[model samples]
Target: MGAHRTSLTAQLFRRMPVGRRPQTEGGLKRTIGLVQLVGFGVGATVGTGIFFVLTEAVPVAGPGVVVSFVIAAVTAGLTALCYAELAGSVPVSGSSYSYAYATLGEVVAMVVAACLLLEYGVSASAVAVGWSEYLNQLLDNLFGVRIPHALSYAPEADGVVNLPAMVLVALCAMLLIRGASESATVNTIMVGIKVGVLILFIAIAATGWNSDNLSDFAPFGVAGIQAASATIFFSYIGLDAVSTAGDEVKDPARTMPRAIILSLIIVSTLYVAVAVTAVAAQPWEDFEGQQAGLAQILEDVTGSTWPSTVLAAGAVISIFSITLVVMYGQTRILFTMGRDRMLPPIFARVNPRTLTPIPNTIIVAVVVAVIAGLVPLNWLLDTVSIGTLVAFMVVSLGVIILRRRAPDLERSFKVPLYPVLPLLSIAACLYVISGLALVTWIVFLIWVAVVLAFYFAYGFRRSTLRQDVDDEEVAP
Candidate 1:
């Protein structure tokens, strides 16, 4: 009985060895350089919110939405430092999930994985919904036609299934099945398209800027800005997705920190610039009820349909890339879990030809596509924010734990202020979480509970580590 209890405890606390070269042995390919890594971070982080969230955020914070951008950036920056340290120290494929497993324990890893599943899956679905909006805008600008509302939006949103969102998810899954290298290459191109269009809008929109737009900033005060920060916080969700590629990243220690910090700076600067220009182009109140807000702002400023058309096209292209990369992050997390025997083995099976997790990608694609076709955007945004915040907090906690537990572990890069930075990250995440609605918190708790129930019933009992123990005993 004592021996049996010991085996159960071992299974619960098992950790994946840090710095395992799984990809070179039997898994994903290592082909991403610092450039591609940075592109992945920026491409995934910049797309969805900047394009469409203004409509929801601006009225809440007034012109102080720019302040909200800065607040979110600072909060995310603190968390990114913790992520960089873990990625350098652990250097595994599962991002925060893998980090928690190595530094904390198996049960913690499962919980983190649940958080990540929500973050990537719901974010992909939300981005797909945003893509549907921009695609509709582009078509209307180019050819004077639109997808019927019933076919273009979720049923709960007063329409039928969102066809474009599902189609976009399906196409992205096909690209992912081809391989990560191919996906990264395409992501680089999409990043260029995204940046170029934003530059064009800034150049054109600055010509008609109004000083009066700056006068009434923070009309709803600090509380409003904080509220908007909570809403816009999900915009930075993908920055840490860069760290998930530690196994595939080149010279990960140096590359991971550089990519994480660089992507944060790039994404934050662009978000703030876009927000300031948007309000300058039109009054804050006008942002409410606005569809395709950025493009519409451009059209209003330039008095030409062409600039709006260009913005919409850029949004459609970049949001597609964002959805693809985010869904890629989701598949890899599942693949890692499968390899650990916390999930079905098929999820870990790599396609020999493509060197990708084909089964995992297909499963993620189908689930997110169904969600994209059905779930309303507003609910998804908060769900994603809550999940991402919890995951970030876990990574920050893991950093503190590993530092005390294994201080000798070699890390390429370390958080500058050590415990101070990680503690601040935790505090900041909780503060932001406080600003979320009560209903959002309730729903998130229920989701976590459901995931925990599945783990105890299946993952804890059938874990790969437990199977290994049984096999060893039989062999002796």
Candidate 2:
């Protein structure tokens, strides 16, 4: 029993071969391009944080919320560098999970995969719930009769079922099932629409700007800024979603890093500008519990219904793309896990016609839809933040490990300052993580423990590396 346990531990730490090209050479299609890849990153990110998070974050940081946006942007920027390097070097699906498997070992990779689930699937559900909120807002603007609270909200939020959120998830699932390139093409157009709408908002909101709003900046101090930044980190979820498409992009080595960097520049610039413009337009104290956030803000500033109606309509259209891209990322991650035998083989099977993982997409959509229907949106956001932050830190660490272990390995892209930048990335992620609530940390710990337990009991015996080890031992 002792020997058996020791051998299992060894197998759990076994690493996949470094520098593995994307399995798309034979499996998933290599059809996605640089432009669509950026759309995936930006689409998954923008609609979630800017649309509704101000209501939650402004209350904590006051007008200092603008600074919080910068804080989160800096953290994400540093981590994005690390991600670009690894995504270029490894060029595989699963994002940070694949990076860890190639460098840190199987156990760490498994933990990262669990984190990816929270980052992709749970965030997808939460964003869909936000979509429902804006969908109601758009309906109220157009027809004056909105969905009833009982039908549109989770039970915890005083509704019996979040029907609209589930419905949105279903729609996105349908798009994903058709094909990867088809979904990416639609997302690219939605991304353009949302970006234009936000630019319109900045222009209009800037006209109403007041200097008084800057007076209360940083009212809650550095701790508050850090805490709000931690929450806002959830906004950057889409940036890494770009990395997860390693298996589907046209040229993984050149396109992966370019898409990640380009998306970061676009997202961070918009995020900071929006934050500054918004705080200048209204008192931070008025942000809490504000529904139809940007739409309501527009009405407050312009004293007209037309601009508010436009914002709501834009949100309704763009948030759909958010759900589609995130669900796409989740399915790809699960498909990679299935290929490695961490999940069932059904998830690994691609449709011959679509060249996409149909079972994986269907399963993700069902689970995310259920979560959207049952859980309050705010309850799940912190979980998403922690999971993505931890995965990012893992990628930063993996860069150092891979460089040391495979010194001569070809890397198309490299972190500019090497150890300094990766170390800063790790420190930035940790600083933000420090601000997470105690319950969030507890939930994260319990979730990781559960995943690790399953690995020892199930993944250990079924791991491909374990099979290889058994074959070596039995050979003459």
Candidate 3:
């Protein structure tokens, strides 16, 4: 009986061999370079996170949203380092899921995959929802006819359907179906346009800066700041998306870490600059229930519609890239899972001409588009934050575990300060996670439970790792 119990324990924690997925035929092509890789990170991280988040975060934190951005940035910076090391070391498709399978075993890997679905999949839907808002603003600016509320907003927002959001998701899916390299090139251009537009906002908004807005910086105090920090951490969701391109990244050891760090710096600067400029331009009390976001702020400050038009135009283009890269990450992770037989084989099947997963992208797009068309945007922020924070905590822990288990492992990037940095990464994630509301926590727990139940019933028996274990026993 003791021996049988021990055998069951071994089966439960079995790890997949490294580089195993890349060994398969018709695998992802390693064509992404440093510039395009940074584009993927920035493209995915910079979008509605900054453009749409202020509408929700400012109401919660008031002018203290600046502090919230700092806290979230620090936490993201720490986790980004952890991700960089693992991406360089493992250099595979699944990001943290691949890392966990190599160190923590199958159960933990499955949980990581669930977190990733929330991080990439749900966030893509959330950003698409944000896209609809900017698209309305852009239409109003260009054609003088905004999309009607019935066709523009989600059901939760009292609209019949979010057609614009669905259209954005579909467009991104089509671009992704073409090829990764082509998508990256287009994203790079969009990134450039968006960054320039944000700088334009700062330059113009700074002219109207009133010192009086700083009077009540922390109306909600520590709790408000923490809550806002958790909410806006969604901005950094795509930083790790760079690592999902593990199989397709050129000199991943060098490129992945560079892209992650570079994008974090770029995103952090823009978020803080935008937050500070917005708060300083208008009173914190005016930030509540704002729907039009940065462009509206520009209109009020400049007393001219053209500035709003320009900002909204940039947002429309940039947010499209965000949804594209995030959805891209979602498909790649599922592709790896499908390769491992953790999911249906169709997710792993790549189109020979495009060398991309067409069916998987289509499946992901349909589900995400449905979500974008139905759910409210604010709820998505909390769900995405908790999932990403938890996933980051897992990655930090995985970093320490891997170092101990394989001290001789060669890594292109190592977390500076060793265990201390990884420990702080875990602590930072916990702090941000604590700020999430009880309802959000309940939802997150329930989602994780459902994924675990699926894993036990299906993944446990059908996973390739399970087959390998049974074969090993029979061989002896």
Candidate 4:
């Protein structure tokens, strides 16, 4: 262990250009602010799961699913706090990957990058699949028609092609190719649409609440609650999207931390409210196999389809935006890895024409499209939760490492409670991870080993930093 630590430290502390560091790329673009950051978090977080999670979670914990929501929220909040400190200290676009490289070491950074790629890449595909379901619902409600089951479902799920989902991905790719940005204004619009539809849901659902539904809240027992919490944990995955905009935030010392905590609080509250109302409007058992559950609840409550139609439309729009943002994030992280010579150079080449990593984005879009088209939503959601939980654990640990190794480094925001908070963050992450299936852990371990092998075989030899270090010693 001691020798391993020495090698890791040596790899991490190797010298490279300070001015041209990946963090210093193209100056900070001030296109986002606190409100916009919060909007991004809310927009990325609100859709898909809240509309559908109760169905999956309720069967596990019954009415006690509300408690699961609170537990997941608290875990997410702790990780987000650690993310805030790292984001503020590093102020980079690669999120946890960049933070890990600066503080943890190259091998750990590569592992974290792999996890992030899974987190954002798989999540984009997952959201696209969800968007397709909601779009079909909207069509059925408004036009009295629906896409054929074979064309609308995944191949594994006995469908031919998820045409609507593929179409959504294509449209988002075109928008990205056209250099369109999801500005703060657009995020605000998406957030408003999402939150407004949810508010409408809560109001309509209030009319149908039955106290009888609260009985037998924990039919599944403690084990069931933990299992459901693990699944529901996916809904909170993007809460740290707020911290990723660290460089653009005003008064980041105060604003960055506040935005993260505030976004988590608001999103968690909305999630619990939605869960409680959905379960109250109907028995917990009914949520199973119920796609677009909230919108359906509105339909049942009003005895009319318009309210549900509107909600479905809102989900369609908001979920598309989420896919776009998450895809953008995945491409950027790969771009950073490429710049560092960890992955192939193709990922690093920014298009001079678009000023975006056009090739990188396309590659990610294609991969995600395939996953969205073929994989089941449940598998996608579970893999995403595993990747995100591991990455969050790394970031929390990275915070403690940086504080101890480079105490004098300037930090715009420091996580409150110091060592204790970060330690708790790790514990919470592990607790949720424990609920994941043994198969998921096996798959995760294999994936990490493959990444580490690549790091040793190619990345170590091709690293730009190693080349720079050699050149400097030769010159002297």
Candidate 5:
């Protein structure tokens, strides 16, 4: 029994092979650079939550939501640095899951995979739901007809189903099935539209800024600020998406770190600007249960519908892209796990014509669509935040472990301040995670438990690497 257990431990701790060189012989094409890297980071980071999170956060923190944004940014920035180091070293597609697998062990990788699945699936669904709200707002503006509340929201929002959100997910899935690609150029255009609309909101909202709104800042005290910080943390979830491209990024040693820092600064600044301008334009108390909060603020400021219309239209387009990107991330993560035999082989199967993971994409789309149709947006957002915070902490720890375990490994990017930055990253993630509601934590724990149970029941016995090990021992 002791020998058996030892063998299992060795198998679990085996590191995945590092792919340090570009695969030029019929492999993935490397074509992105620093500018495109920053673009990707900014585009992924500035979606969905910013469009609707104030409705859920403002009542808790009042005007202090700006402070909340800063708190979340600090934590996310720290983790992005850690992510940069690991991503530059590993240069794999699974993001945190890949990092953990390389540094920790197979079981830990499975756990990280569960966390990532939560992050991507919930983030995509939350973004889709946000898109649904904006789509309704845009239709109202353009055609003077709106999707009825009954078909536009989940049960928590006192509606039958969020049909529009489900429809959005279904549409994105079809696009994925047809091998839709968001090239660097296309991503840049989407990023421009998103940033342009946000800038327009700030410019208009700044015009109506009043100093009185600042007076009641921190009305709910430190605890409230922390709670709101945890909620808004969802806004910064995609910053690591930048680091994931390290494999293809040019001069990754210098470019990866710079892009991560610059993009975080840009994203955080925009978020703070939006929060400050929003609170200044209207009392924070009025934000609760507000649909299309940003657009509504603009309408209230100018007493005209034109600015709101434009903002709504921009959100509709940009958030649709976000949904697609996050869903693609989800599918790819599952494909990696399936390839490892941690999941059924079907998830790893790709269509020869499209060269995409069709079954994996379908499964992800179905799950996200169901959640978008049934669950409330705020619930999905908080759940996503919790999972992402945990994953970020894991990645930070992985950086430290890899540094200690493989001191001779070639690393393009390394975290500065040695253990200090990675330690701070872990601490910051934990502190913010503490601010989440008990219910969110409970739900997260239950979800993770379910994934682990599935892994033990199926993954342990069927892992391809384990099978290969057994076959080798038995031969000759």
Candidate 6:
């Protein structure tokens, strides 16, 4: 046990060499500005989930789900502030993985990387599954024919492969492989489509709103509200993607901070508006077993399928973009791990032609595709929530650590209320976590242990940081 403990410590705490860090491949141009950054965060964040989350959250809190949305936005707001500071300080692509490495030790970074794999990778799969649902809805409305449930859902549900989801992942992977960049212009266009759809939804649904529907607020009580908050949290996951692009942003000190806050406010406001409209237009209890809930709401109100079809088509396009951005984030984090020699070196290798980590992207794409095609949406959502919450907790703690340890570091943004805000963030995270099932927690722990095991078995000896230290000792 003593030897095992030693080995574990050695592996997980492995370090990186400052000299070996890869140069910016292809001398990639830094063309992103504040507008572009805001667009990326907004585009990557506001889709599929918000359209569907209302169906789940409203029943839990009734009309009180609006308050729950407020709670979630506040928590996400605090975390985004912390992320802005770290991103400005580190200015790297790996997001929290890069931040943790600079402030915490190597071992902690690996664990965070593992959490990210679940966060972005699995979440992409989840989004693709959502896209599949909307795509099927769009087809049925436009063509009066529906794909067989057996051909459209996972085999786990007594069906064959999810062909549409698999195709979506594969297409995204190809774009990524070809270095198809999601420039600020493209992101802004996508954001426009997303926002326009929601506005259309609200405008149409408002005609059907009846205040009586909100009278029985909190039908399920505090327990149900808390449960709903955990689910709603999924919609807030990509706010940090804004922070991850810190290295390339012009005047990051100012841009990084504003973009993060602005994006959060815009997204939260839209989400709450959508949720309120959906609930007011129809009874909250009827949201159960709803697929393409927002689009369905439109159909019910208009007594025609055109509005629903438009929303479904918009969802399909916007959700696809979200999956691509998220999947991109996942591969970059793994590349950072590989670069540090904490995982296989292959992950860090950038392709000479694409200047991206082609192999790593392929591996991530394949794994996520399998999960999307086979796994159930409910399982994917729960696992993603757990990973994201833990990672957010770490970022909040990192903010406190960096403030104390390196008080002189230039931070473009700082968390307001200091320790109070961070403490509140942590508490809210735990509150949401408390609602997760026992099985989810058990699965999370097992995944963490497996990551720690890999760190000890391989990362210890090959760590670039350790080798650099050894070389310094023998220098003439």
Residue by residue across 301-391, what tens digits does model 1's lDDT show? 8889999999999999999889988998999889888987789899999988899999889999999999999988887888888889998
Report the lDDT tens digits of candidate 3 across residue range 317-357.
98898999999999999999998889989999999889999
Candidate 3 has a TM-score of: 0.97
lDDT, each prediction: 0.87, 0.89, 0.89, 0.77, 0.82, 0.77
Candidate 6: deviation at residue 147, Å?
A: 2.4
TM-score of each: 0.96, 0.97, 0.97, 0.92, 0.93, 0.92
**Clashes in model 5: which pairs?**
none
Model 6, residue 124: distance off in Å is 0.5
lDDT of 4 by residue, 1-476 (tens): 12222255576555332113433454333456677777767877887568766767788888888888888888888899898887767765677877777777677788887788778888888888877778889999888898898878898878987877788787777666544244446657878888888888888898989888888788888888888888888877666556555444555556666667777887888898988888888888877778887788888888999999998988888887687667766776887788889889888776655556678878888988888888767777777788889889988998998888778877878888989989998999899888888887887888888888988898876878766655665663
Candidate 4 lDDT score at position 305: 92
Candidate 2 per-residue C-alpha lDDT over 392-470 given as tens digits, one digit per residue, 9 for 90 to 100: 9999999999999988888889999889999999999999999999999999989999988988787877877777777
lDDT of 6 at 22: 35
Better of 2 and 6 by lDDT: 2
Instruction: Look at candidate 4 and give me any clashing residue pairs.
Output: none
Model 4 — TM-score against the truth?
Answer: 0.92
Span of ten consecutive residues with least summed lDDT in model 2:
1-10
Name the regions of candidate 2 deviating beyond 4 angstroms: 1-6, 21-26
For model 3, the stretches where C-alpha displacement exceeds 4 angstroms are 1-6
User: Candidate 2's C-alpha lDDT?
Assistant: 0.89
Clashes of each: 0, 0, 0, 0, 0, 1
lDDT tens digits, residue span 327-426, model 6: 7777777777777777798887877766667888899989999999998777777777888888888888888888887888777677878988878888
